[model samples]
Target: MSQPNTSPSGRPATLAPLFKASAGDPLLAMMLASGGDERIAAGPDGRNRYGASARPEAGEIWFSSSTASGVSRRGWQAASAALPFAFSAGESEDWFSDLRRRLLNLLAPPGAQAVFCASGTQAEYAALALAGARARPGQKIVNILVGPEETGRGAPLAASGRHFLNSAPFGSGRAGFALDGWEGAAALAALPLRNGAGAPLPADEIDARVCALVRVARARGAHALVHLLDSSKTGLSAISRDCATKLLRDNPDDVTVVVDACQLRCAPAQVRADLDAGFLVMVSGSKFLGGPAFSGALLVPGGFAESLAARDQDIPWPEGLADHFAYFDWPPLLRDRIAGPFGARCNSGLGLRWTAALAELEAYCALDPALIEMAKACFQGEARRQILMTPGLEMDESGGEPTLIPIMMRGAEKGAADAALRKLRRRGLHLGQTVPIGGREALRLCLSAPQIVDFAWRYREIGDQNFAFGPLRADLEKLFTAWGALLG
Candidate 1:
C-alpha cells in the first residue's frame, strides 16, 4: 500500500492512487481500482454519463422546469455561504425565518403567511389537507383539470377514499392512494378534466361551472372545495382570475379556492390579487425562480389561522406528513396545536436549498422590470422567427410571454423529437426534455434568470462576461441550426 498524493495547496490531488495488495484482499483492490477510475474521469466530459464532457459541454441550455435547473453563480455563492450555518448553529435559530418573511413580502400577497416544504408536491399535499380540513359537512373536493396532462400527482390524494372525476387513474405508476380519510373532507374531482388547447377558458363559463359545482356539492350536503390550477404543465394563467374571484364571492361558504401557482410564473399583480381575495397560492422555487429542484412553499392568506382554529379538533392530517413541514415558523395558534409536530424535525439540506433559492429570487427581483421585459421580447422574437423558418419546427403560440416556450416538431415518427434531442445532447447541447403535447411529443425552451442574463451554458463560463439584456438571435439561431442539422 502507498500514501495518497497531494497538491501544492496540501489538498488531496485530483487523481487517485493504486497499489499492490495481498491476494486475500480482493474487495480492497476493487475499491482502489474504482477510486482511480473516478479520479481520472472527474474532469472528463461524459464521465458520469448524460453526455457531460471534461472541457465543459457546450449549449447546455435548461428548459425543464419540473426536474432540474442550471443554478446561477450567485445561487451557488449563497448556498456556499449559508451551508455552514445550516449544518451548525442554524437549527436553533430560525435561519430561514427572515428569508421566508422576505420572500413572502416579495412574491406572496400582502400579509400572507408562508409554510415552507420540501417540494411542490409536498406543498400541494399540505395545501389540500388544509383545505380539506375546512370542508363543511356535505362538501366534497372538486379538482377541475384544464387539460388531460396532469402536472401535480398529490392533487388526487386530497380526494383519497372518495370518488374523483377527471383525475388521472388512481394508483397510476408509483403513486398510491392517500391514507387518511376525512368524513366530508374527501376530494371529488369535477370529472372529464380535458381541455386540449392551452388558451384560457371563457370567464363566464368558468364562473358558471364553478358556481354550479358548488351548488351541486351543497345539495349533496357538501361544499365544493376547488383546487383551481392557475398554471400547471401547460403554462401560466391557466385559470382566469375573474372566475376565481367570482367563485369566492358568490359561494363564500360553499367554495374554497386553492390557486396552484406551482410554476411560480404568476405575475406580481395576479398573485397579489389572488392572495388579497383570500386564495391560497402554492409556489415552488425550483421553477421560474431557477433555484435547485424541489424547493416550494404554500402561502396562506391573513385570518386563515383563525379560520383553521375555528374548526373542530378533527382535521384529518395524515400521520408523519407533519415532518416535511417542520421548516415553517408557525404563528402561536398553529405553533402550539395544529402544526406542533412541524419544525420539530427539519432537514438541513432543504433549508440550505431554500436559502440558495432566496438568493436566486433576490437577484431576479433586483433586475429592472423594463430590462427583463426587453430581454424576454428579444428572446421570444428570435426564437419564434427561427422556429417558423426551420422546416421541421413549429411554435405553440397559444401561451407565451416571459418564459416557457413550447415548440412542436413536424414528423410522423413516435420518438422523432426525443431522438433529435439526444443527438444534440450528445453534441454537448441540451435543449429541454420532451413532453407530450396535443397527443404528440414536443419540446420546451424555458428561460431562467441565468439565461436572461445571457450567461453561457457552460457552468464555468457564467460570470466570465458582464450581464447583458439584448437580442438572443445568435443563441436561438445556434440552437435551431443544430436541431436542423440533426434532423437532416
Candidate 2:
C-alpha cells in the first residue's frame, strides 16, 4: 500500500513500494538504444570485456571479477598498477624474489623447487610433461577431482584428467582417475591407484589396497603416474586424505603423487604438508587471493625435481600443456649440458608473475591474526539482516567459502529467472543472471566487496528495491502485483 522512495544519497526511507521498472537490463538498454535496434550498434561508443567489441556499449559494462573486483575503485587501480610486476614469476634472482620468500607469496615461493607455471593450465602441462618424462612404458597416469556426482567441481576437462589418456603406454589404453570427497576422505574408500570399476583395496589390509592398482596396472606393468587436483575448497580431498594416510603407512615409496593446488594456494600449511608427503603441488594467484589472473605456481619435492636430470635427451617427451591445469615445457638439452643448476619446468612468457596479488595477500595469509577479525566485525550487523532478508535464496549456514556466494531463487524456473534478471538489469542494480551449473540454471554472486557504498543501511529501510540505482517501489508493484502478470 505504501510507496518506497530514496533519499539524495540512494538510501531507502522506509518500507517502500516499487518504482517504475523496465524489462531489459539497464546497461544493455542504454547500449542497445544507442543503436536503436536489437542488433548491437558499432563505432566509438563503448568497449566490452572481450576488447574492442561493440557488444558492451560505452557506458554499459558487464560485471566481472575478471577485469576488476566491483568492490572499490581504489582497490582496482592498485590491482592494475601491480599487473606487469605480478606477471613476472618470482625467482631468487628476480625483483619478486624477496616477496616470494614471505608467507603472503604462496603462489610463487622463493627458492622454488620448480616454476609451477604462469597459468594453471600451464602448471598442469608442466606436470604432464614431467609424467611423460618419468612414466615407464605401459604405466598408467591418473587425474583427480572433487565434488559429488553432479555438483562436484570439475576443472576444465581439457585440463584435468586428459593427461593420462594422452600418455598411452601405462594406460593399458585406459585412463586413471583419482577422486575424493569434500572432506578429504575417499569416495567409497577408493584410491586413485585403482582403475575405473576396479574393486577398492582394503585400507586396514595393506596388501588388499595395493591390489587395486596392481590389478589396474597389470596390463601396463606396475608403473603409473597419478595427479590429485585439490578441488576441495578447504584443503585435502576426502578420498585423497584417506588414501594418503593408508598409502604412506603401507608403501609410501612406491607411489608418485602430484597435487593441483591451483585453487588451494590460500591454505599454505595444508599445501606444505602435501609437499612434505611427496606430492607435487600447483597453485594459482587469483581465485581466493584476488591476485593477477594469469599467475600461479607449483611445489615439487627436492628429490622428485632432481629426478629430471636423469632423463636421456635422445627421447622427445610429449607436450604436457593444458588449457587450465599446467604450463611451460622445457627444451631438450644434451646430457652433458644438463649438468648445472636448473631454473623451472615452465616460465611465464609475460612471465606469469602476480607480484602485486602476492604482496596484497601477505596480510590475508596472516588473516587468522588481523584482517579477518576486522572483516567479521564489519559484517556482524549485516550478517543477521542478510540471513533474514534472503527469502528463498540458497546460502549454506553450515560451512562454505566466505568470499563467493552461489544462490538460486526458490520457485523461479529458467525462463522466469531470466526475465526477472532482465527486469533488474534495466534498473541500475547490476547483479548477475543465472548460468547453467550442476545441470540446472543457477545464479552466483562472487564478491567480498570492499566498502564503497553503504549497502546495509539501505536494506534496513527497503527490501530488494533499488534506489536511483533501481526502479521505484510503486512502479514495480504496478508491474507485478499478481502472479499472472509475471507469467506473461
Best by lDDT: 1
Q: Measured by C-alpha RMSD in angstroms, how accurate is candidate 1?
A: 10.2
Q: Could you estimate the TM-score for every candidate?
A: 0.76, 0.54
Q: Candidate 1 at residue 109, lDDT? A: 59
Minimal lDDT window, size 10, model 2: 179-188
User: Which candidate has the top score in TM-score?
Assistant: 1
Encode model 1's per-residue lDDT on 1-488: one tens digit a residue: 11123222211222212112233123221221121112112233323222322222234555555434644455655655554444342234446566667777777655577777566656655666666667654346654444325455444543343212122211112235343233444545543233454344554565566667667767776655566676655463444667777777877776778777777776666677778888887787767776654467777886665677666654545543543455233433443345333434345555655776787777677666765676667667677778877888887665544477877888747888878777876664556567676566777777666565443322124432223423245556667888888767
Give me the runs in candidate 2 sitting further than 4 Å from their true place.
1-118, 148-156, 159-237, 248-254, 310-316, 319-353, 366-384, 396-399, 415-441, 445-488
Give me the displacement of residue 213 in model 1, in angstroms.
2.2
After superposition on all CA atoms, what RMSD does each candidate show versus the true structure? 10.2, 15.7
Clashes of 1: 11
Judge candidate 1 at residue 89 and give its lDDT: 28
**Candidate 2 structure quality by residue, lDDT tens digits, 359-470:** 4455445344333433434333343344345555443221143433334455666575566545544432233345444334443333322221223224335633244223
TM-score of candidate 2 versus the correct structure, residues matched by position: 0.54
Per-model C-alpha lDDT, please?
Answer: 0.56, 0.37
